[model samples]
Target chain A: MKNDILTVMWKERKGLFRIRGRRAQALLGMFSPVLLAIFFPLQEGVEWVQSPLSLLLAFVAPLILVGMSIPDSFAGERERHTLPTLLASRLSDRAILFGKMITSVAFGWGVTLVLLAIGLVTVNIAHWDGHILFYKPSILLADLAFSFLVAMLTAGAGVLFSLRAATAQEAQQTLMAVLLIPPMILQFGLFAIMGSDSGKARLQEVLGALSFEQIILVIVAVLLVLDVVLLMAAMSRFKRARLILD
Target chain B: MPSGIIFGFLGPNGAGKTTTINLLLGLLEPTSGRAEVLGLDTRTQPDEVRTRTGALLEHSGVYEQLSAEDNLEFYGRIWRMPATERQARIKELLSHMGVWERRKERVGTWSKGMKQKLALARAMLHRPPLVFLDEPTAGLDVMAAAAVRDDLEALAGREGVTVFLTTHNMAEAERLCSQVAVIREGKLVAIGDPDDLRARSGGPRLEIVGRGFDENALGLLRARPEITAAEVHGDHLVIDLRQETDTAPLVSLMVSAGVQVEEVRRGKASLEEVFLTLMEEER
Candidate 1:
């Protein structure tokens, strides 16, 4: 029964994504994944880029894609007034939420999946100069699992934010501000605070010393639980009245 | 047998017409009143009702990007209509609504009338007995509105499907609705056949046209217990007389009051007048 709803949701969202054609949503989505791949990927091997480019490959791209895209998909629905229509349908609010959440996370993860493919091709090409990082599809697959969960978190948060904004732009803006802040902070070397580098390391250097894989797992797990809880919360707040007015 | 009732609901603006329709379709919560569709309470049996009902609430809700047939197919899946049935029904509905030629065309590319017609087709696609239409002709031109009215009338009269329709167009209501409930300010003012409501609010009307008509005199007639309505049309006063009241008495009252009376014509009450009078009472 749950899978039934999820399947329908996947179909519906696939339609939504297919609304304008995958030529754009899927392509434009690649933009962020590629940027993150180029910049966020572990450097060749500076004692910091751990677990072969393949493991880090599985983790970071999915996480970033989920964090960046899922919420925005919700904003798209809120903008299109499709949410209100969906709410009025026969499906229970939970089913609707679950379906929509699935779409968001799936799309987010989907984009990451595409990016991973592109990155894999590019990573192999880049490593042609005698630097062969560990090559394991299972490591990449595990990262995908974590990415899906994080995508749920972003999607739930986006939907919750959508309830507060009148239009898609407002929802995206509000969520974007919230979502962008953490990454900006992290980019500013704030992540260095968690590093265990012992000597001659400033704030960023120390944060950079911790293994990226451990950080990814802890963050993915925490975000996964929060995402599930927030989705339930979003489902509860997902009433017809709020949808029409919101 | 049709699983859904093409229930007919009619209410004027501000009468919670939109709100009521929304509630019926599970688009909104009823502040007090509860609605049941297909033997299911809208609140608890939303899924059952939705699956059974095909609604065109307000206007076109097409995804706009998809073609007309695509929209119908999408909604068909949502209603759990069979995959094999989806395409055939979409074609049938689009043809019935006279949009089959444009089935492959995007909804966003269609005109307002076309969009509305397509929306109606989509609503009727699932063969749901219960269809809720909230001013489906709202944005159409006169000819389109008439076409829609004809379609609704045919659906109800020929198909025997109960259609719940809400429209401010009294003529449309009179033509399309077997029974209408006039609502104002969230309260139901009157409920019955249009003819019955008109007949019940009856008075033999004396249509008098004359020069220098005393406007205040008509007001006096309205004040009288016997006069149900006194409508001033340019130089004429179309008066509705009470059952117990005779036209002779009105002539006498005018004579006694020293007023000149012109040609008097007795006429039946119109639904428009009856509803206007009902709304007046509500105000």
Candidate 2:
């Protein structure tokens, strides 16, 4: 099973990097991340690593990156007419699913970490801090865990959308729309919460009651359950016969 | 049923040929029946069956973005062929297809024929005991189709692997298949040697290219008990005779009827004619 997963990953990586126009798209995708990694740290100095805003970067990085990649990975295979052959191969359902998911997650999370690390170096070199600048252990842990969870969430959702989509572009667009819904709902919920004095008082009381660590833990826990549910849904929907018919 | 023979699966469009191949390859479940490949039940042990069998599906299923070598390398890994063996096999297959020098070029850049050769190489890379090829020459030009056919023939001959080949080209089936099965609407209509089908698909046929075949000659030819069908097709008189009937008597009768017979030919029905007749019967 491990070997099979690796084999799928090998193909995924080759396809991601070596495909004709995809190479250009990938390089272009990296441009924004590289710019952020360098410019943000130089501008903010050690505060870039010290603040919780770095966690926001980490979270958004994976959301964007994984959202972009997972659709291309799953829907792209079907669009290119390669999915049937892959399905007809000896690889098990779990192996192919996990292999593709892992590749996208790894790419998103790996690049996020690299960007954060580069940010650290840029802070140290350009800002000329007397001592080394790095993320606090708690902040770093939150970044890794949250970013990974978000990446998994995006990938899981991407698979579901890709399964039904006719083309990779359509899958990507639909997934992006789905991803925006959560934030939109959150915005509406926050507005409702702050609409009245009683609601604002309750919100403040809840926030005041929990420490940042406790809040982060709660968010991560919710994300973990959502990730598992979405992943399971994607797995159950991935039927070979259905895919072939499509 | 035998190993090391190229079996041709012949059928018209929408005849469930692809569906049957999918079931045999364990990509789909049968509604009421079962299929086995390489001694493994496709329903219960699909992975095992797939592990031992290779398929080039209806589409080439080649990654157009990857080079020809990388495409084979990818499938070779899927079959878990080791690095050394995979490299050697890729080289061998590409060389045999006469595309070894262009292995590094992207498949999309190559002509349709070249991509098909590479796809065939990928299908045979793991050296499975059996392979399924679905219309390997479906969309190629005349020269390209002929080239692919040559490669398919050579590889099938040299590898000694069981091949389940589905093709619309009866000529290809006639040329390469040891046994052929004709299916229509998800059911097997006829399965036998091509020659046996041709023989059983009515009987011996005779064509007389002549200018003097009139209604009297046609009526007389059709009225005979031994002649099943006699019709003027363009400038020739085509007659379908009952099995084992001699043509000499028919020729004598036509001459007596004042029909000018410029040339006489006795032949078995071609595979295409048999296929059309079966479809007509089914309809």
Candidate 3:
């Protein structure tokens, strides 16, 4: 199983790096995170490492990266006429699924970590506080967990969308829309809560009641569950015969 | 099911040739029946069957974005060939196909013929006991098709691999396949050695090329007990004779009818003729 998965990964990685005519799109994908990593660290000074809000960058970074990559990996294989041959190989269905998912998630999560590290160094150098400034351990852990979970979420949803979409562009569009729903709902929920004086007060009271660690923990748990559900959904949708027919 | 021969699966488009190949490779499950490959039940031991066989599917199945060497390297690893041996084998196969110098170039940049050759090399790289090739020379120009046919002939002969080839090219099937199976609409029509099929479809045929043939002459020829069927084919009169009987009587009859016979040649029907007869019989 390990060897099979690795073989799929090797192919996935080769395809990812060897993409043609999409370099500009790839750089554009990295542009936002890179700009934020540099500009935010420079503008926010040492506050960049001290605030829990920095977790937003971590989450969105991977969401964008993995969202872009997972669809291309899955639907792109079908569109480029390579999926049937790969399915005909000795590799099991799970091996192909997990291999591609891991490659995309790792790429997104790995690059986010790099950007985070670069952001930290940039902040330290610009502020020159005569001490090495770093994100608090709690915030760092939250960022890692959040970023990894979002990457998995995007990848899982991407797989599901790619399975039905006739083209990579269609899958990417559908997956991006799916990924945006939760945040959009959250924004509406927040607006509803803030619209009422008593609701706002109660929300603040509850927030004040719970420790920051507890909030971060709750968020991580929710994301973890979501990631698992989406992963299972994607897995159930994948079948060698179905894919061949498709 | 014999060992070490090029077995041709002949079928027309939409005749389920690719589906059959997929079934044997264990990539597709039969709706009712089951299949076995290399002694492994395809349904139960699909992975084993796939690991032991190779396929150049309908589309060549080559990664166009990668170099020829990379494509072979990837599949070699899939077959778990060792590093040294894999490299040596890749070099050997590419060199054998006369595409060694272009191995470093991406397959997308190569001509369709070269890509087909590379794909064939990849299929033979692991030297599996069985290989499936679907229309390997389907769309190539005459020269390119001949080149690919030569390569296929050489590799099939040299490696002693069992080739399950699918094609609509009757001439190719006649030349390369020792045994052939004809399928139409998901059903097997005939399966046997090419010669047997040609013989079974009809007995010896006689072709007389001359312009002095008319409907009266054809009617007279068809009336003979030795000739089963007679028709004007292009500018010639073709007769399907029964039981290797002499054509002298038919020729004498034609002469008596004031018809001229420019040439007389007697031989078995070609595979194309056999295939057409099978399809006609099926319909």
Regarding DockQ, does 2 or 3 come out ahead?
2
What are the TM values for chain B, all candidates? 0.81, 0.96, 0.96
Ranking by TM-score: 3, 2, 1
Candidate 3: which docking quality band? Answer: medium
Count of clashing pairs, candidate 2: 0
Candidate 3 overall lDDT versus native: 0.88
For each candidate in the order shown, give its overall lDDT on alpha carbons.
Answer: 0.66, 0.88, 0.88
lDDT of 2 by residue, B82-123 (tens): 899999999999999998998999888999888888888888
Which residue segments of model 2 deviate by more than 4 Å?
Answer: none
Native contact share for candidate 1: 0.37
lDDT of 1 by residue, A142-209 (tens): 55766676566667778788766765557656775776676688666544544546432565564577
Better of 1 and 3 by DockQ: 3
Q: Which has the better TM-score: candidate 2, or candidate 3?
A: 3
lDDT string, candidate 1, B1-283, tens digits: 1332333455666778888777777666777768887678987776777777767766466667677777777677767677788878877777777778878887777787777777677667767777778888887899988887777666556555567888888777777666778888878788876767887876556877664457667666778887767777787777777764468777666656556667777777777888888877877
Stretch of 10 with least lDDT, candidate 3 chain B? B242-251
Report, to 2 decimal places, the DockQ of model 2: 0.79
Per-structure clash totals for the candidates: 14, 0, 0
DockQ of 1: 0.36
